[model samples]
Target: MPAPSFMGIYPADSVQEVHSSLPLDPLGPGAADLLAGDVEFRLHYLLQEAKKFMVHGKRTTLMPEDIEHAMEALNIEPVIVPPRPLPQAPFLAVPVPSGTSGAQQQLYTVVDDEIDFATYLKEPLPPALANSAGVKWKAHWLAVEGVQPAIPENPAPSSRAGPSRLPAPTTGAASLRPSAKQHLTTELQLYFSRLTAALIPTLAQLPNLPGNSTPSAPQYSFPDAERHRLAALASVRSDAAVAGILAYLVRWVAESINKTLMGATGTIGCLVDVVEAILDNDVLFVEPYLHQFLGPLLSILLTVPLGPHPPPSGMTPTTIELRTRAADVLAKLVTLYANGYPGLVPRLLSTFKKALTSSPFPSPLGSDYPPAGRYEGAVLGIGACGAHAVREAIWGTNGDGLRSINDLIGLLYPGEGRRNKAPLVRATMRALQQLTTPKPEGATVPPPDSAEVAEVFGPHFVRAFEKRPWQAQELMRLRKGSNGDAAAVQADAAGEEDEEMEEVQA
Candidate 1:
């Protein structure tokens, strides 16, 4: 029977031809259509089964083995077909060219010969080649006498031929070296003694002498011995005795603060130098003694009248300068140890508030209290803490911080026509500027925007400045200008200032 045709897929003539080849009975009417559909369905089923086998072997393309495996899995017996011999074609021969060399002819003949893998495997391996000459090795002195030969083993001639003249000490010698503790202690004591003597004003000099009779106050000097001591201390790498030495130094400074304030500018400067030297020493970490050192350092920074009070002014220029120095030191300490001492920023903010908020004590003469150096120090200290610390400390969870900032801002104008507060006002303004300005380098987070500042202090900012007309100018100055305008203005002002100075000189 003949099979029906699928549209373009299977032709009716081909199916009829195939059916006629098979030795079967005559076809029924619908037999061809049923047979064609059944053959198509069976082919699709076989292909799907073969694909499963292909995937199981982790292959993309289908192989003959996959079809065989699919037939086995589906319980379908594969049809076995006898292999047929391939037909062979007669070889055609060509005559060699008359100009060809014998060597080239031999190469062509070798290529035409049939290769037998079994015969080649049966052949014995070839013998090794004989050595052409006897082996020899010779040695020679790399260095002749004192001068070394310019060989690969030796360094370049420009480099040192031997070890340096002053060779580093060996472990044995280093172990025998004497401890520097005792020497450092002696030097520190001597330096502090000299510093104290120079800083403390004598009773004879205490009473202001008429005219120039009162000789110039003694200047604080760093002697060679003191410098050597500081160098030794800085060189000491061991942290073992550092705590004790730091404590002793802190004690000396604390004791001298009172006497030094009696016109001991030189002593204060010397003390500041010592503190800076200690801070600069990488080997000595003062984290452990931070609390102990903070008290004395803050005393220097926030002391009311740094110099003698009986003088014309409560705070002299030297005293103000010392206060500024102390403030700088305090700021450095806070920056380095703030994380270790979590409460440090809060404590500093508190001290700043107290300095600005406390009413001035009545003087002996009943005159209005003069502005103290402590106010300046407090303002500088707050400014040095950086913007983030300033913001967090002043506007943290507690509302008191913002209140303090407001009080400080209020003190900028202090009513009743008193203008002696210019220094305090300037310091406060600087601190405020520091708080608002974004750090140009090494800042991890962007500074707070004007909106954030307004959100924090907006409610009280206007009210705080409303009563004080003088503060309006300061408030206006504190407001940040647009980036482009500020930059242009700064450049123009600098150029104009330079030109004016040059014209005046001419």
Candidate 2:
């Protein structure tokens, strides 16, 4: 079929149809063709002018307002109809069919209005009517002094309140002024650029090692002069404003890591350092921003394929180390805000359980066995949350937790031992040990005995081993020897402490 044409040209057939419709006062010669062509040209001109209005409004599409504005600009009067009730149809009840079901047997009401045939047969349209309130131009400001005021033209408030606490207002007359946020945003952008530049260099190789690693003395020193300057500026700022700035920075860093494959390690490292500096600065406030920080921090911790474009072979050591640092930041956040935010621990644990179990690659021996850096981060994050969280995660509602733990064990130490994800397995073990370890204050419940552990895990133990035949012995050792070994290790540590004390006295 040929494509339809609508380039403003009226067809001859349409002109003939229009001429035929009007018979009482028929057009002579080529009058119908001339009228149709004129009408089409006028419509096309109106549309073109409307598009110009749209362009002035910084829009690509023409709207009803643009058409109205165009008509006014062109000095064209629009036909306005007076407010009148629309013609109503007479209601009639129709009988239901006998064969219909009981539910469908009810009478149906139908509107059957009588048509005015004469109105359709009219030779020409009635004279263009003008209503009592005829179209007239009214002027209003779309924006005033760089701010769209809450006037009739712009009634809705520009700033919306988010779920988090509202940011504290700045001092002076600026608080009452409009566009104050624009100024703050400009200032924050400047600060963020400076901070990003300063921090990016420190990211590749931080003066202080991340995680548990610590040098006897400072391996390297932070550029205190620069850091102190930034911290001082941040300290004097309002808590809410500083929080907003940090939140934006966090989002930027996360986007850079997820969207860009190159420089992911440096980006992640820079993020970790920024967070550390914020936490370490006693002068700077963080409470108001804690809620905002949770999501970006969690995203950084658990984003699958932390770097989409890894080394040609696999993940580089830098990528792995970057992920480890990210996980540590997650743990720190949990510790800092777990008490204030009751839901933090549960959510973190849930993320861990999901990451550990949900994998696209089924076989551990396959090239894709390691999963993503985020999955490993989840494991480390869980361990950092504390033992109670680990217990709840592994022993979810109604023994679901026990099943999840068994699944991880099977995946990590399959019987065949084709490939062992050492880092993942070690993280899981650390979480388990943390879960089972006794607390000094007895705040948490003591670890369950061997009998309980066996009973809870026994049902799936055989099936898990069956999938990986080589890991049966390792599973057995985990089940039988974990408690005894933990006890012995504690005893040995105590013995060494006693010898140290004796040497000190001598």
Candidate 3:
């Protein structure tokens, strides 16, 4: 069939035909129109791509195989073609009743080959394998020094497909071998295909074939793709047999996160979910690749503005939600690996502190100031790393960082006191509360005088806990006996050590 003009916009009816062919309910006209637009765009893209393959092949005329090559390169499922073309069946014309009385019309239809059921039944019955319960089994060494021995339990080598026939990770047919590509099995390739089709589908659904996004984006998460995504996440979470592709999955998550963090793409809420799934999967051996996730997670948490330009109304909703979600995953990951990997908590705590307190060279607020959204994320990250981080990281030696934080909060909520001013102030106070003893919800612990609260935890805490005396009292009781300025110097010494250690490790 000739390809449609890439610029031509399709109507809902065209998209409906695709649904009808697949046994799915016809899409709503609105959705169909949107899909039609996307389909037209892909068709245009596919034609341009096919021309490249045609040029490379030095052919002026496009071949069926050239189109197939373009589809495969775009991650589309290429249509398999037979090596030898079959002869076409001749069309038969039969007389059919026309508009009126004696007039007749001829209708053309293919005369398909018919079979005799009686003869087919009498000829033979195909053999069937026994059920699992009925089958006999025996165990043997399938391979000794990487060679499978042919036996009653094993298939003959001649009948089995080998590594040379299997698709390589790259385009390396010659370089791929059983020994060299031990883990790159057919199963792994299938797993990758399905997983990519589920999570990042835009490319897979190219030319409007079965597929999302550049793997299909629901403006293309077609119902089936959404289900596939959930099932894939569940498999990664609970399946114990996927070690061969664990590294690949890790890189996939990091890459998705980078694309969004670097502003090259949009929110990867699914990748955040993937990270959480992997972190929750206790069965997986993830320690080796644990560091791979940190860079991307931190980038999401601390990258300023999160996009090319800040919205006039301030941080966008998507940006806020992503930062919040990334912070939670970072916390779970850091807490999980903290004990085995010493200095993990403190290192992250230091990093968050720098973002929270230090402004870069071209700061609008000043060199001492940082972006408000990033600072808020820093507080959330520090809280996630560990609650104890507030003492050494936030309070600082003699409360220097806390002083800067208090000034920022005061500037944000000018003339405000006696209540939580904003989410940032709330987050900072909550981190401080972590260092205090827990008070029951019903218990009424009288707060310290405003002067004393400011003296102990700095003025920011005073602003944060002004009305909530329970939180204020907790900080007062815990910090009363501690030497304030002197112990801060000691904590500063420890904070410096964490900084130096993180630098060395990096």
Candidate 4:
């Protein structure tokens, strides 16, 4: 649908008349209409902005000063008319000397009012006002930009005791003596250097080892790195005034994920660990960086193989666990921040859903739709979003060519990374298990019959959870899904009168 037309108060004839009064001559037929529309838009914007000033000032009606303020804001020079203005001067129409022999066009000018300068000067001298205080100057620090001087210009000790104060570098940091990056304090530069050195130890920082071919991969076991790494992670978990470093750290996370994801498992794990550490820090406010964090988290969780090439024999559980860790961070961000940031959950759901449904990579083992790791990560990410998301995406009625997870998991044909695929299956089961409605503290959740478990979660889920009967029974419990499916399943389970308690109790 087209946008509705906003009828403007400006008219074409008035614009044409104003144009005709100028030396530029009358505007063409169509030009005046266009100019009128433009004028209306500009006038509307100015007045609308002017209304803000009125509202801010807590006034009932807009004042003339507001319009002037709006003009200043828009960088337009305003016509400053005095409050007690003279009456509109009569227009003096003079015939313009157009070279053509046709009719001479008229140019209009405002008749200027005469003033008595001698009388105004005589009137101002009537009373002599007391001389205003002569200008004098004094200065104290309002806010210092960089390293403060040792002089008295600095605020005193009691004044410097506020929470905004930056911490001084330790003796170790003083020896390193790293210079501050633009606008960053010496303290933060030292902290970031130590932290990166500990957590993401690049090969260049170490001595050139004789046998290593992979030069750039991060060595997590670098000399003295682990001790410093633990200290760095602990510091991040409790550091104050780190908000200034947040943007740089987010950029670092993104860049490191892109560079290290295909090369080394340890490096990627370190990145996720740092993310979790930052999230764990109650001192640093992360709300501003939530959106930025999503890109790196999604990259970690959804990117397949997690290496340049597939592992020769079996997928490393360590590499796969990185996605799990990333999912945990993803969940922490969504579960905690979703309420404050509207659309965050839906956007996350859309991303995971897209990845979950994408076409499979052709593998020798068998194409199990999308890559197994990505599928598992997507499931975990959605599950992290809480019950509503898990309920809809996994168990809700199919739409947009969607199928339930019960149906989807069954389609996981014998594929590459099949060993690691067990985790994928387990991830699915874990997500569904989280949806069980809470029972009273003393009460127990009634388990559906084993025969009904196959009916509710499909044959594949029963097989997946067959050995662990309680898990399948957990899925069979009343789900927190919004639709009637969960209730229907609950009712069907409730109606089974013939089952022995001993049969399902096992």
Candidate 4 collision pairs: 360-369
After superposing candidate 2, which stretches have Cα over 4 Å from the reference? 1-181, 185-190, 202-251, 257-263, 312-320, 359-375, 395-420, 436-506
In model 2, state the lDDT of residue 135.
46
> TM-scores for all candidates?
0.39, 0.41, 0.50, 0.53
Better of 3 and 4 by lDDT: 3
Clashing pairs in 2: 394-401, 396-401, 415-468, 415-469, 415-470, 415-471, 416-470
* TM-score of model number 2: 0.41
Q: Number of clashes in every candidate structure?
A: 1, 7, 18, 1
- Write down the RMSD of all candidates, one decimal each: 36.9, 26.1, 26.2, 20.8
* Candidate closest to the true structure, highest lDDT: 3
lDDT of 2 by residue, 32-84 (tens): 55556657966887898799879988997777777776665444557763233
Local accuracy of candidate 3 as per-residue lDDT tens digits, 1-506: 33332335666678778788886864653566666766776687788879988998999999877777666554355333434354677999999997768799999999988899889868743322222123355689889899887776788876677433322122112323333244367776677656655654342232232231333333544455466667888888888865656766776677666655534222355677788988888789887677788888888777765743433233233565677788889878977888987657866877887787665334443434335667778887887877667777775554455677777776555564434346677667766666767777688766569887677556666656777787766655555545565578799999999999999999
Worst 10 residues of 1 by lDDT: 168-177
**Model 3 spans with C-alpha error above 4 angstroms:** 1-183, 200-226, 262-266, 307-318, 360-370, 396-401, 410-421, 446-463, 483-506
Error of 2 at 180 (Å): 8.1
Residue 70 in candidate 1, Cα distance off native in Å: 88
The lDDT for every candidate, in the order shown, is: 0.54, 0.55, 0.65, 0.64
lDDT of 1 at 323: 67
Model 4 C-alpha lDDT per residue in residues 397-448, reported as the tens digit of each score: 4221123554555555443334544676677767766665443466543444
